[model samples]
Target: MEDLVLNWDLGTGGLLLLAVAAVAVLLVLIMAFKVHAFLALMVTSIGTALAAGIPPNRLVEALGFGFNPTLGNVMLLVALGAMLGRMIEASGGAHVLSERMIQLFGERRAGLALSVASLLMGFPIFFDAGLVVMMPIIYAVARRVGGSFLSIALPSAVAFSAMHIFSPPHPGPVAASATVGADVGLVLVTGLVFALIIWGTVAPVASRLIGARIDVPVPDILGDEDEKTGFESRPKVSTIILLLLLPLVLILLNTALNTVASTTSDPDAFKATPWVAILRALGETPIALLITVFASMFVLGWGAGKSGTLVEKIADSALGPICSVVLVTGAGGMFGGVLRATGIGDAVAESLNGIGLPVIVAAFLISQIVRLAQGSATVALTTAASLMAGVVAAGDYNQMQVVALVMAMSAGSVGFSHVNDSGFWLVSRFFGMSMKQTLGSWTLIQGAMAIVGFVLSLILWAVASAL
Candidate 1:
């Protein structure tokens, strides 16, 4: 079905009200009525679509606009990550890796070790993919250390978010830089500086505070802890490290090639080279994860004397537990998609655009509002940057000022992660937190990151102006 043209325009105020109502109803259904998250999301999506003037005949199509693409992106990563994680967990690689980490970092600072690793990993990996891949290690560390799961996991989660939102090579900041004409290299350096500051200061403190109060246990999503055995047969820590690094290296290689290609005068020709194409293909997240999974089967599976049938069962077991997680995440995407399709984000952005705020402040506020409205950080960042493009071009700002604007918008795009955001569900389910716990902790963590990032950007803006 073709995209439905909205015949009846809900004024900006009306659209905003509808967006708020949709979220309210969604929360009540899940929180009060105790409805399943998937059902609540679907119901809210359908209702919101209709109320926003989507024609009845095209309702299914409108739903597909968000649902299909989200599942297409999320399913592969979640499934493959789960499979890789299962293999590692079953093979006791996670245990060995965690043991080595504790030995290296000492138990007193295991959370610090995980955070630093995650920050490094986050540089090359997207948030969801990185989080999924890191969960087994996070779980192993939390269990061995014997404390609140969030204390160990939250810092790593925030680290990934910090890198993903602020840094380059991740689509959001890169796209925003392009849209607002910021220097990509400057943005990368500035982003890394701020991302570290935000992650280092904010993540650990929030993790400890929330972890102390909430006490989310390590989830059994990969496999039961009791079922794991044969520790002596587990892969050596070096072997486990190689298995974990495979995807990261592949992904990094792909990112480097693409970056090099983009910088060449004829980017198309550079990318068209067969060698480049082949390398990029290998580096694609799904393909990279797929390669690691197969590699694990050999080194961790057959090499360990596990039968092919047993390896197959291990992979199969990973799928069943993740079905609900995948569906609910996709449904969250569906709800966000419905909101996006309704044009509420555009309505809100246009209103915010006219407010005459300073460029940096406007960038953050516009991105935040659009993100809250639509649930996609990329969409929010790009939209805010696009809206600010004319103003930025006319302003004749220095490179640092322009970079500050991009960072401010990037920060805004990350805040207020809630039910509509797919990452929220991903974190909630993977960590075994109830919806309330997720809201109380994860949401606040993200909010704090955003606020601190924005403040830091403001400082940068001031410094740039003075220089």
Candidate 2:
């Protein structure tokens, strides 16, 4: 279902109070009381809904509205992406890629290479999924190079986080663009420019400064020891790279065609062409991933000389671990959804209009508020965009400015990931960092990236307006 259709009866003060209470209770449950994230989120959602005066009968509907859609969008990607990653890792492709990267970039630049690779892979994969897929390589590189886990891990994780937040085909910016009526092509283009600038300039610096202060031990979550089993039979680096790039190429082609088709004078011109339609379908995110998974089965499985049953077992193993990640993420979405159902985000966005800030700045602040209140960046993005849609319509922003606004909203959505965020836990568990260590590293990295992204977006907005 779409975000809750709410005609909020509560005034701004009441809604704000409820939102603060809900977030407080959620944090207390998870951080202080040590409750499982899913149960805590459910109880808090139900309590907050009642306190916010959502009718008792509609409470379940509201929870389901938030939970199911998030589960639907995320599960397929996470599951399939994990499967592909498992196959790659199990087949020793991760080792091959890391070794090749170290050779090409040398040891000093290996971390940079991994970050760049993650930036590319992040184009098609979600942040968590991309991080999972790259974990083996990060571990391999760290082991070979001999350094702090943060040195190798932070850059790659931050790269994925930046791309996921600031670019399209990752839900946040795409939904934000749609909500605010920004051109998706323009947003994608401008978002890419800003994303690269932000990640390239900011993430590495943060890795050196912040990551140096925090020490984290890399965990063997990806079954790295088993990688040696098929080391000699691993697929070539080119083959692994091809598998990784397949979805991105398809998705980009689809984006390019849709942009061209939308601009055509005759709307039906592209639709009349069967080949164009088919290509677009293939470019769809889910379809692109499905095709990539099947291709991987042949390339990484049979082509690599692994038996069919072995490949099946490998993929099966990938799913069991990610069940918590998927559920916690969905629960984070549920909390954000319940907040939306109460119209708290809307109230805050509406309040921002009289604050004398630029709309782009206002958009960023609103998104950050929603993000901090709830735990899901996607939820923060959509809720913030929904609230800003009316303001954006009235502002008459130019195309570039509109794109910048979308990026700003995206930046805000990813601003601060703390206790309530499933992503926080995922990073902590996967990288084997304590909660405090994660706060110092992953949380700091995301916060720094978000601030840098917003600043860059503001600069872009200024330049665009001046032109």
Candidate 3:
């Protein structure tokens, strides 16, 4: 869809105000009125488009402009990823992998072991899904190892949070990368690197310190009885590991080939080579994920003794839970399209330039504000990236710089989880922590993760600039 032709213009100041008011109204609807994010975003987008004087006839076109393109790139990846995760979770691969990690790490370092396992599992899994799958393992470890539940559980929870916030295939970073025109492959590589760095430095220390200070016992929310009863039938740990690594390896291969092609005398011709084309096609994120999902069904499903019908049902089941996530993401894109069509993005870019605010810093701050207001990292990330899409387009950023900017925004999105956030409640209830205890521990861990991630992004931005 083409940009809408404006009959009347809101000058920069007016456009900026419109943007602020739009965001404010969006926050109010989501927070105060408890409106669903999808509905809130739709209402705000339509209102903002009208308020900005978009021609009545072009309003629908303007909305679809952003929504369609974003969902086109994002929806397939999310759906495939969820299917892969469901297959692994349902096959008891998650449990078997966690048990193997504990054996290697030993009971003395069970917290670290669970954290490492969660990070690997978190690659294809959403935060909530991975957490729920691993809770039984986390609880069992806490019981056997006899430690503060926070010490055992917090690190693992943060590990999933780290991967979800920073990495690709997860809706938040994927949508943000798409909005800002960052390469998903590069985002994946950079996000994984930084997620590990931040998780390594922050999670264990913070979890142990907080766990030591406040001893919350593991709750019976997920009972310990028969925790390992069905593990004998699960896929081997090595098989599960390979399943998790398949997409990452394929995507990275694509990135590597693209890099090699870029250095050739005729980059276009290099990419057009028959073998290279075929390889790149396989390496595309969606295709890689699709291939992995099938591989998972065969390995985790049939190879593990599940019937073909059962495998089909497992994949089918994955789609229903993610429909809301898919729609909400599409709605966010619609909202972004309205901002771009109305020229609010351009106005904000010029305002940032005039105020001498660095785009990367501005990206983080804007994402943080939205995150603090609404408590959904995906919402915050998509909204902030949409707002900055114009600025990123106007700037002379290399791919690395753009990726760094996305990382910074993503870092901001994951910070400060509190009562308003569903994840906060999920953690509190699962661990049976009081409200105050959760505030002290989970919230603090998230804040630390965000700060460390942003700092690493700043360093990456500098490195990219220097290169």
Error of 3 at 18 (Å): 2.0
Q: How well is each residue in 116-160 modelled by candidate 2, as lDDT tens digits? A: 989988876678767765777788788777767778888888788
For residue 36, model 1's alpha carbon misses the true position, in angstroms, by 0.5
Q: How would you encode candidate 3's per-residue C-alpha lDDT over 108-132 as one tens digit per residue?
A: 7888878887898777666765665
Better of 2 and 3 by TM-score: 2
C-alpha lDDT of residue 329 in model 2: 69
> How does candidate 2 score on lDDT?
0.78
- The TM-score between candidate 1 and the true structure equals 0.98
Candidates by lDDT, descending order:
1, 2, 3
Model 1 ranges off by over 4 Å: 1-3, 228-232
Clashes of each: 0, 0, 0
Worst 10-residue lDDT window, candidate 2: 224-233
| Candidate lDDT values, in order | 0.91, 0.78, 0.76
Best of the candidates, lDDT: 1
Ranking by TM-score: 1, 2, 3
